[model samples]
Every structure is written in structure tokens, then in C-alpha cells.
Target chain A: MMEITEGSHAVAEAVRLCRPQVVSAYPITPQTHIVEALADFVANGKLDAEYITVENELSALSACVGASAAGSRTYSATTSQGLLLMTEVVFNAAGMRLPIVMSIANRAVGAPLSIWNDMQDSISLRDAGWLQFYAEDNQEATDLHFLAYKVAESKEIQLPVFVCFDGFILSHTYEPIDMLLQEQVDQYLPKFDPAEKLDAKDPISFGMYATPEYYLEFRYEMDQAQKRAKDVIAKAGKEFGTMFGRDYSALTVGYLLDDAETVIVAMGSVCGTVKDAIDEMRAAGKKVGLLKIRVFRPFPSEEIAKALSKVKRVAVLDKNISLGAKGGATAIEVRDAMYGSMIPVKGYVLGLGGRDIRKKDIKEIVSLCENGIGDQFYGLRKELI
Target chain B: MTLAVGCRARPGKSRDNKTGSWRVFKPSFDHEKCSKCGMCQTLCPEGCVHEDAEGFFDPDFTYCKGCGICATECPKEAIAMNQEEK
Candidate 1:
């Protein structure tokens, strides 16, 4: 049924349907509504689960680490500084291969402090061993959670999954989302049964010190699981689409690329604006297209390269920059993946600290690609510099 | 190896793991001096020490790291630290 619901409530409703035995979180700007709604669900007996409001991000994730290790399906949500604070245990959860599903309301990391939208926070932790998925809208954000839990619990790829949506932009926006019935979700995602967890009757210690002999091997194994998870993601995504209507098997979706000379690549909610811009540019006879990256980690390099293999020029719009580097995280990864192809992929960093990225910005980026004048800061105010 | 091999979530499997090789010093027990007070058993870091049938405690060397905590805590001086055997 279609409902005009706040994005955060939609996500919380999805979590309720998934029936995670434990839901823990710490309140953070733009992300608090998600956990607060769930807290209400648990309190009113609407959802029979333990809803914990931990004092800080560290304890919130640490609580999830313990709950997931104890054989329960776990869910948590956080943003920006809250995410940065939990960085250690975020790594520990994946290092221990706990299948906990987390929602990252993507926001800008601050030196001066701004609670706003950006991809930097989650993008910074790209190599932390968790499967990362970026959503373009509230519907995708809600759907990705269902898909995330399925993929995380796959026997071949038992790892944590992060469902990331833009902070406030998507989290606070109200949109009509078609939600599935409870029975449909139950059929799609069965109860959490695990091959391993902390059972007192069958005690086993994890996160043990690996000697030099085994440390490298453990890391190597994490890499291999990530490589394997590529196939698992595709398979699980297909199964989900078959059961529901929205298919997401393709990691990179290209719009109007058939004979386009220039293509703009992006991720997260900004893709919505990019797509709208692409439509206007197409009407003006500009040979342009849009490529949206749905999954960031396990970085989908091969699929992305293949999608853009035919374009003449590629402009990457990154919402987060890797400081001291010439380009941002998404641009750096795209450029490296398309290396040796002679495509001249340009980097355009834009929308830091939730700066407005209008259609004019997307059009300008594409126009710069067309004129071979990109590979520079997007919408840069030279006066400010 | 496609699955995460080191990320074990189960409990009770620590018993299967061996840890004594980390030892540079091994604890040697003097049975005649032991009053069977169980201090060594209670003070063991690895939880591998056990009180045997006669109430005398012994460390399971298989998982003991030989940290010398048992010898330092033994009130009767019944335990001594020795270089680990080859």
C-alpha cells in the first residue's frame, strides 16, 4: 500500500517487519527519529523485541556486537560523529563476522560541526569489511534493508550490511512508499537461524588474538568473503526482486547512455537530482547520461567500468572528498577502476556539509565534461578560497 | 575460505584452541608443598587450571600461557616458574 510517511518511520517499520530480536541505538541528529519510532514500537508491545536506548554510539554498537554474537538478529542506526565514534566496534563486528544490519543516515563529518547530509562518514569506512549499500530515495532505503538482511545472513557471506541514505534529505523527507504486507516480508526474510553464536551450552570465544601465524590469514579470509559476497549480492537481489517487484541485481544503473558522449556518475540521494538534470540536458540535444552506484563496498569496479566502457567522457560527482587527495572518494575509486581505458574520468567534488546541489550544478558538471573542462572542484566559489 | 573463517560466534569452542606455546616460563608445581588451597586454580588467566581428585590444583598446560600468575599468587610457595620445554 502507498503511504505518505516520513523516511525514518518507513525504515523503522521495515525493521519491525524484519523482526530483529534486538534493536539498539544512540540518538544523533537526523537519525534519532528512526530509533525513537522503534522504541515506541517496542514499548507499546507492537513489536516484541528488546529496544535499548544506549547512552552513546560506542555502547549502542557494542550492545549490538554482543546481541548478534548471541544468535539474535540485530539492528541499529546512527549518523556522522556518532558513526565515527563507533568506528572501532564497527570494525570489530565485521571482524567477528556478525550479521548485524545497520542504517547509516549519511552525513558530513565535521571539524566545525554541521549535522547535515553528505556521504563522507560512511564512505570513509569503505574498507571496514562490511557490505555497504547506498540508497537514492526513501523507497530504495526501505527496500535495501530487506535486501541487506537477506544478503548478510547468506551462508556464503555472513557479514554485516550498512544501508546508507542521505541524512535529512531523505530521512526527513516524506514520500509515498509501497510497503509490503507482514506475511510477504516473513516469507521473504525468515527467522534468524545461525550456524554459530554465543550459546552458554556451546561456549566459544571470538575476537581472540591471532598470532602472526594466523593474523594475515584472517584478513585474507575477510577479503575472500567480500569477493564471494559479490555473487551473493546479485543472487539475493534477484531473489528479492522476484518475490517483490523492484529489481536491484544491477549494481550500476545507467540512464540514456546508449549513444551518449558524456556521462555523470554519482551515488546516494543526489542521483535523483542528477537524473532530473539529465532529462533536461537530453531534451536540449546534449549527449549525456547518468550512472548511479547502488552498492559502494565490494566496490563493484568491474560492473561500473563495463557500464561506462562506451562513453567518451565521464564526470564523477563526489559528495565527500578525501582530504589532501586531488579528488573525492567516489571519483578516486571510479578513476582507478577505469584506468588504462583512456576515458579521462573527471572529478567534481560537490555538496559538502549539505550544500544545495541543484539541477544547474549537475548540468554544469555534464557541460564541463562535454567541453573537456572538468577534473576540478564542482561549484567552487573561488572568492571563498 | 569464502566464508569468514576466523569470525567464530559460537561459545565453548575455546576449549579446542591451544594457547600454551606463548609461554616463555612454565609453572612447576611442588605436590608436597601444596596445601590444595586452590589459589592457582582461581588465579589462572586462561581458566585451564582445575582442582584434581585430591583437591590439589593443576594447570592444563595445553592452554596455559605460563604468565607466572599462579606461582606469584600461591601462598605456600608450592609453585615455581621454569623455562618452557622444547
Candidate 2:
């Protein structure tokens, strides 16, 4: 059904269609609407699920971990400080190999308190063994939830996933989304039938203490599973495209790179603005394009390298900085992917703490990249410094 | 060898570890002075102390780490922790 709806409501509807047995979350800004809509679904008999009201984000993800371990499809949502609070359980859920899917309403972490959008929250947890999918719009945000569960629950890749969309940009905005029917989602994603679960009859333990002799192998196996998820994600994404018209088969999707000299790479809802900027730049005779990264965890290194192979220079727009590093996390990884190619890769860190990133800002960044003036924070107020 | 997914294991695998090798002190049971109250068995953290056929309790050295809880909890002072020669 094609209807204009709020991003959070659309995601809530998508989650309802997936039929998670347990939905656990603590309400945080931007993410609250999704869970609130879900709570209404469970309340009005629209969805058959247990809505576990937790006290905080830690308990929220902890409840999901417990429910998922007991062979139930579980979910939770958090952002920024909330995600930081759930850090311990986050790693435990992945290490335990529970196919729990979480929604990360990407928000900026605070010291000088701010409630806004940035990729810092989920980006900081990139190495935690969970597959990350960044959404470019509300439609992709809503649709990625279905793909997240399908891939997470696959037998060969039973790892948790984070479907991250910009906090206010996607979660609080209204857009026309083609919501999936329950029947369609059911055909795409199967029931949560875990190979191992916490059944009293089975008498097995999960996440048991591993001595030095076995701990390394356990970590190695988890890494292997994460690597295997790339194939599973591609297959599931293709199947989804076959069932639904929207395909997400590529980890990184390119726009107008056929004869481009400068390529702008990014993730999340900012890609929408970047695409618009690229179109405008193309009209002005600038050979610019975009390579938006959909998946970040099992980073499409080879695919990314191949996609940007012929570009003259690369500009990576990172919404989150790596703190002490010269560039954002995405730029660091992209540079590593483009290693030995002799291509000059420039990183521009911008839009932190939800400073608006407009088409003009992207154009300015492209000009700066052309002038070889990058690897620094973009759009910083000179007076403040 | 293939490891279990998620480091999961079946119950009772703890018995194979022989944790008694970690014991520096061993609990010697003095059954002659013992009352069959089973306090030592009740207080054993490892649950390694079990009652013999005569209703007196002895610690199973195979799994007991010699924590000395049994000796301290014995109401009759019938258990003693002595330094193991090993």
C-alpha cells in the first residue's frame, strides 16, 4: 500500500508485519514513536507480541537477549546515550549469536548535551560483531527491517543486526512508503526457528565461560559467521527484490559514476541530499557522483574498491568523527579499501550534532576536494575556533 | 576439532575438568567425631560433599577445590583442612 506516513510509524508497521514474538525497548527521543506505535499495535490486538516495557536501554536490550535466547524473534530500539547504556548486552547478544534485530535511530552522543542526528552512536559500535545497515530514506529504513531479520535469522549467519537510519531526518519525517502486507513479509521472512535455544528439556547452556584454549576459536567462528553474512544478505536482498520491486542486493550503490572524476561516498539519509547535489553538479558540468554505502559491518571492501576504481579522486562525507583520528570511521575504512590504487581519497567530517548539511555544503565539499583541501572538519565556525 | 556455536555446551561437562587439581588444601573428614546432621554436605559450595552409606559425609576430592567451607560449616568440628603435600 503506497501511503504517506511518518518514518517511525512506517518502521513500526514493518516490524509488526515481521511478527517478532518479543518487542522490548526503552523510549528515547526519535525512536520513541516507533515503539509507541508498536505498543499501540500490541494494545489494540493489531499485533500478536509481548511488548516488554523496560526501565532503561540496558534492560531493553537485555530483555531482547533473554527472549531471543529462548527461541523467540526479539527487537529493541535505542540511540546515542541509550545505545551506550546497552553496550554490554549489545556485545553479549552478538557473541551469543542470537538473531535479535535492533533499530538504531542514529543520534549524536553528548558531553555538551544535544538531541540530534549523527552516525556516531552506531558507528562507534561497528566492531561489535553485529551487521549494520544504514538507510537512505524512510522507505529504505522501513524496508531494511525486514531484510535485517531475514539475514540475521539465517542458519549460516545467526548474528544480531542494527538497522540504522538518521534520528530526526528519517525517524521523524513523513514520506510516501510502500508498506508491505503481512502475507508478503511472511513469504519473504520465515518464522524464528532457532537451531539451539534455552529449553529446559534440552539442558544446554549458551555463552558458557570459555577458557584461553577455546576463547580464540569462539571469536574466530563469530568473525567467520559475520563474513558469511555478506552472501546471505545478498541472496536475501535479491529474493526480497524479486518479491518486492525494491532491490537492496548491493552493499554500496553508485549513482552516475560512468564518467565521473570526483565521487562522494556516504551513508544514511544524507545520501538523499548527496544525490540531489550530484544531480545539480552534473548539470553544472562537474563530473561528480555518489557511492552510498548501505552496509558498513561486513564492509564491501572489494565491491567499494571496484565501484570507485576509475574515479580521479574520492570524497567521503562522514557524519561522525573518529574522535582522535584524522577522518571519520567510514573514511578510514574507505581509504583502506582504496589502498594501493594511487587514488587520492579525501575525508570531510561534517553534520555532527545535527548541523544541517545542505546541498550547498556538499557542493562546497566537492570544490574543497578538487582543491586538495580535506582531511579536516567541514563547516566549522572560524569565530568559535 | 569443531567447537560448539556460541560456546554453548551441554550440562554436566564441568565434571570432566577435574577442578580438584586447583586445590591447595584438602579437607580431611573425621567421621569418628561426626554427627550425621549433614551440615558439611549442606554447606559445601561445590556440592562435592555427600553422605556415605553410614550417614556420615565425605567430600568428593575429584571436583572439590578444597575451599574449606565444609570444615568451617561443620557443626561438630568433624572436618579439617590440611595442606596438601602436592
Candidate 3:
């Protein structure tokens, strides 16, 4: 059914349809609506699940870890500082191999303390061993929840996942979403059947201490599982497309790259603005296009290489910076992907702390990539500096 | 051999690892001075101290790292941490 709804409520409805056995979360800005809606569902008897009202984000995820270990499909959501608070257990959940699904209403982290939309929070934890999916719009945000659970609960890939959508930009905004019916979702996602669980009938221990002799091997296996997720994501995404009409089979999706000389790479809701900018630029005879990355983790190097093989130059727009690194995280990886090909890749750190990324800014970035004048902060207030 | 997913293992696998090898000093029980109060057994961090048929507590030594917590906590000074003679 298609209806106009807030993005957080849409995500909550999608999660409800997936039939999560446990929902635990601490209410933080932007993220509060998602858990609030889920709480309403459980309270009104619309959904049969345990709603754990926790005091903080750490406990929210810790509750999820315990619930998931005990053989229940669990979920949690948070953003920015809340996500940072859950850092220790974030690594533990992935290391323990619990297939828990989390929704990250992507927000900027702080020294200055701004609760605005940015990719910094989730981007900071890219190495924490979770499959990350960035959505371009609310519809993709809603749809990705179903896809996240299916992939996370797969026997071969039992790692956790982060379905990241821009905070306030997508979460607070109302958009027309084609919400899946309970029966349709049921047909797509099976009940969570854990391969190993905390059952007293057959005792087992998880997250045991790995001595120096065994620690390296455990990490190697985790790396291998992450590499294996590419195939699992492809299969699950294809299956979702087969069932639903919208296909998300590609990791890096291209828009008008057939005869383009310059390509702009980005993730999250900014892709919507970039697309509109690209259409306008195309009319004025600028050979420009976009390659929006849906999957950020297990960084799709090979697919990215193939997609941008013909482009003369690449511009990566990052909402988060690596601080001391030469470029943003996405640019650093994109450059590595196109290393031997000798394509000039430039990275621009823009839209931090919810600074507006207007179409004019994107158009100017395209011009900067064309004129060979990037690889620095794109928009800075010189007068303020 | 395939590793268990998530480094999970069956219970009691710690038995295979003899932590006692880490002991630099062994706790020797002076049974004559012992009160049979089971203080050593209650205070053992590794739970390796147990009572025998005579009701006198002794450390299992297989899993004891000789931390000497029981020796320190014993009221009657019945347990002593003697340096292991290499």
C-alpha cells in the first residue's frame, strides 16, 4: 500500500512487518520517532514483541545483544552521540556474530555539539564489522530494512547490519512510501532461526576470550565473512527485487554514465539532490553523471572500478572527513579502487553539521572536478576563518 | 579445522587450558592449623579449591594460578603462598 508517511514511522512499520521478536532502544532526536512508533505498536497490541525501554543507547544495544544471543530477532536505533555511547557493544555484537539489525538516523558527531544530519556517526564505525546500507530516499530507507534482516539472518552471513538514512533529512520529512503488507513481508522474510543460540538444553558460550594463539584466526574469519556478504547482499537484493518491483541488485548504482567524462560519487539522501543537478547539467552539454553508493561497508571496490572505468575523472562527495587523512573515507577507498587505472580521483568534505548542500554547490563541485581544483574542503566560510 | 563461528565453544573447554602453568607461587595448606571453615574454598577466584573426605580444603592446582587470594583471606593462616622450587 502506498501512503504519505514520515520516514521514521515508515521504517518502524517495515520493521514491524519483519516481525522482530524484541525491540530495544533509547529515544534520541530523529531516532526517537522510530522507537516511539514501535513502542506504540507493542502497546496497542498491533505487534507481538517485547519493548525494552532502556535508559541509554548503550543499554539499548546491550539489551539487543542479550536478546539476540538468546535466539530472538532483535533491533535498536540511535544517532550521533547516542551511537558513540554504544561503541563498545557495537564491536561486540558483530564479533559475537549476532544477526541484529539497527537503524542509524545518521547525524553529525560533536566537539561543537550539533544534532544535525550527516554521515559521520556511522562512517566513523565502518571498521566495526557491520554491513552498512545508505538510502537515497525514505522509500529506500523503508525497503532496506526488509533487505537488512534477510541478509543478516542468513546462515552463511550472520553478521549485524546498519540501515543508515540521513537524520531529519529523511527521518523527520514526510514522503510517499510504498509500505509492504504483513503477508507480503512474511513471504519475503522467514522467521529468525538462529544456528547457534543461548539454550540451556545444549550449552554453548559466545564471545569467549581468544588467546594470542587464537585471536588472529577469529579476526581473519570475520574479514572472510564480510567479503562473503557481497554475494549474500546481491542474492538477497535480487530476491527482494523479484518479489517487489524495485530492484536494488547493484552496490554502486549509476545515473547517466554512458558517455560522461566526469562522475560524482556519493551516498545517502544527497544523491537525490545530485540527480536533479545532473539532469540540469546534462541539458547544458556537460558530460557529467553520478555513482551513488548504496553499500558503504565491504566497500565495493571491484564494482566501483567497473562502473567508473571509462570516466576521465572522479569527484567523491563526503559528508564526513577522516580528519588527518589526505581525503575523506569514501575518496580514500575510491582512489584505491581505481589505483592502477590512473583515473584522477578528488574528494570534497562538504555538508558537515547540517550545512545545506544546495544544487548550486553540487554544480560548482562538478565544475571544480572539471577544472582540476578539488581534493580539499569544498565550501568554507573564509570570512569566519 | 573449521573454527566455531564467533569464537563460541562448548562449556568446560577451559579445562583443556591448564592455567596452573602460570603459577609462580603455589598455595600450600597447613592442615594441622586449619579450622575446616572452608574459607579457602569460598575465596578461591578460580573455584579450584575443594574439600576432601576429611573436610579440609585443597586447591586443585590444575586450574589454580596461585593468585593467593585464599591464602590472604584464610583466618587461621592455614594457607601459605610458597615460592615454587622451579
**Top candidate by TM-score:** 3
Write candidate 1's Cα lDDT for A1-385 as tens digits: 7899999999999999999999989999889899999999999998989987778999999999999888899999998999999999999998888889999999999887999898889999898999999999999999999989998888777789999999999999999999878999999899988767787787776677665546787888888888888888888788888988888787888888889889889998999898889889889988888889998888889988899999999999999988889789888899999999999899998899989999999888887877888656787788998
For model 3, state the Cα shift of residue B48 in Å: 11
Once fitted onto the true fold, the runs of candidate 1 whose alpha carbons sit more than 4 angstroms away are B1-4, B9-86
For each candidate in turn, the TM-score is 0.85, 0.87, 0.87
Question: How much lDDT does candidate 2 score?
Answer: 0.92
List clash counts for every candidate, in order. Answer: 7, 0, 0
What does candidate 2 score on TM?
Answer: 0.87
Over A120-223, each residue of candidate 2 has an lDDT whose tens digit, in order, gives: 99999998999999999999999999999999999999899999999999999999999999899999988999979998998888888775556798899999
TM-score of 3: 0.87
Model 1 has a DockQ score of: 0.30
Best by DockQ: 2
- TM-scores computed on chain B for all candidates: 0.79, 0.81, 0.82
Q: Write the per-residue lDDT of candidate 3 for residues A238-342, one digit (tens) a residue.
A: 999999888877888999998989999999999999999999999999999999999998799999999999999999999999999987899999999999998
Q: Decide which is better by TM-score, 1 or 2.
A: 2
Best candidate, lDDT-wise?
3
lDDT of 1 at A40: 95
lDDT of 2 by residue, B1-86 (tens): 46778867788765445778779999998879998998888888888888888888888888899999888888888888899997
Q: Which is superior by DockQ, 1 or 2? A: 2
Ranking by TM-score: 3, 2, 1
